[model samples]
Target: MADIFDKKPIAAFGEMAETGARPYYRTAAPDAIMAGCNDYLGLATDPRVVEAAAAALARHGTSCSGSRILNGTLPLHEELEAALADFLGCEAALVTTTGFQANLAVGALLGPGDASFSDMANHASLVDGVLLGQGSRHRYRHGDLDHLERLLAAADPDAGKLVITDGLFSMEGDLCPLPGLRELADRYGARLVVDGAHDIGLLGACGRGVAEHFGAMDAVDLFTGTFSKCFGSLGGLLAGPAGIVEYLRYTARPVLFSAAMSPASAAAALASLEIIRTEPARRERVFDHAERLHNGLRALGFSTGPSVTPVVPVHVGHAVPCLRMWQALHDAGVYTNAVVAPAVPRGRALIRVTPQATHTEEQITRILDAFAACGRRLGLVPERAEHDWTPVALARPKLTP
Candidate 1:
């Protein structure tokens, strides 16, 4: 008999499990290592975060029991929303059950007259938001201001356009050219929305994000971020002008219908925010770990893409070879990610690596040693360094387009 599972190609991960070469989860013994999670701050294990969550769970019980639009509007939710507004310096904020929902709610609420211009590399949430908004949407090439400018020039000047982009692209770890993005939006009279899911607590003066990085905080129209990443929580938020927020609270089906995030997650996120302000070193440690890995990989003659942030991808451009390196790294107890075609173009195969603020020097060294050993084992690295080899990790920045 024909079977659905039999006809479907094996999942990339199922193939790995078949080989008995890689474990499906991060290590927990000795020193645990998680390669692909977005926990940039390492706050999931922090005592204060755990305590705050425990207190919230004790006070509020297990769940909110309803949507926030109705009976779910608990005091804890209000407190967290208020804290977020104050913390991010926005006029108002609406916390959603997940980061995906925050973007979805906002994108869905921006009525018929509005439109959105998105970056090509935007996260799935933002893309989903625009799709649900029921308005016109156009995506300019990743970070190409020229492409954005040209598109704006061609569109009606009076069109209500929202320029949306990820502050720090998740795959490349490079920041959007906010200076240029802001200028184009200004020239074309469009509002700007920055998806700072990968930016907060890792960029800018106090981690307010790209606006903080580019000194254009006041210029952005809306900012959205996730609690899952640096905050070590599971909710999402939209911080922006008061009226738009109040409008979404009443409308936006996702916000209106979705159940509230648990009190524990909300409280944990609130505590993480306090720590973000008090301990700036977490942000510094992000850079420290990034530099060590970036410098180490470059020293070994790997083709790491332009990675200004902690996320790094070394291009191998062939699927089989890329998988081989990923398998080797996983077997060596130094975990990593394998990115392939369609998610990227057909010719661009990558082994993506992320370093957290809490990663130790020993871990960093282990990671490099694994990559070096794997590269040699697979003949990806020459017997000796290429005569023309130069460290390309930070040698040049690619303009998004």
Candidate 2:
């Protein structure tokens, strides 16, 4: 009872606000380098993306003011869906008001007679969606193909089956086993669904996403993605065969009940998608930057758990230390996300660092320098003999509030 009463609320680190689309952002410390945003290509601040939204707002006003089933369907909506279908190499696609809703719509298609095999590390939206379906939910260990295979083999042969996984695991910064999951789906007569929230505009040679990266584009039964991450907009998209997509348009409750996406959002996503396809250099830069950051962190004696993508998690092991590290880094003019219990398991707290294509080399260097200083001060890493430990931080974060 004493422990419970004395427990304090976890430190709130959600104070950073973007002044523009660049690497530096306005926070309590004035200006700090943004290394934690999900905007992989930095398209959120691109002039083209901004102009598209402005143009859309001028042309279509503000809100759709109704669900797509009623009067909400606009020309931009259809155009974006068509463009998404072409980009993703699907027969058809449907746009949702939110990525969370997209997953809910897909998973709600399953019921008592259906079964869903999910990865243990899949996004909460996918997990909750499957639960809402009221189906037999079989959770396999994270990225364990052998365990997934066994689960699939043991399920009822005649019951409808679905396999759900995130294209990229958000916490671990690892990708899903697409080829393995595809093979398992073929063997077990299950439809494979992917939540490509972090994959679209980043994965594959042509930026088609995980299926394209794995050469299983045609094998996937459903591909769901979000505009918030890659496109720097707001909304979700689900791409599949015409029959399935058409059925979802008619039957998905989220689509029927929810207000349609704002016109500016649809336009911005469409514009961003075009730029993502045309600008190959942006994608290449992001990959190279991710590699540099990953190697730099490991060399500084920080453990990045299985990260080969832009999303990098530096393992801190304990919740308190993790919070301290985040604060230290914040004071040194670098912003990062502090992951703790409820988001991850106890003793697995971490600092998540994500790099953007638009981040300059100088910004990256500054970030590394700050991390080195903070890590050494916190005893999180060894002190380098070559460098003096002068603090670069202007102010430390306020943890009480």
Please write out the lDDT profile of model 2 over residues 1-401, one tens digit for every residue. Answer: 26657865443332222111122243534578988989989999999999999999999999999999899999999999999999888999999999988998886679788998999888888888887786688999999999999999999999899999999888878888888888899999999999999988887777877777776688689999899998999999999999999998998887779999999999999999999888867877887777777778777888787766888899999777787888788878899887877688878989999889999999899988998899999999888644322211111111121
Q: Over the stretch 152-233, how does candidate 1's per-residue lDDT look in tens digits?
A: 8887666688899998888777888988888888899998898899887777767777677777778778888899999998
State the weakest 10-residue window (summed lDDT) of model 2: 392-401
**Global lDDT of each model?**
0.80, 0.84
TM-score, per-candidate, Cα-based? 0.90, 0.89
Error of 1 at 1 (Å): 18
Q: Identify the leading candidate in terms of TM-score.
A: 1
The collision pairs in model 1 are 143-400, 143-401, 144-400
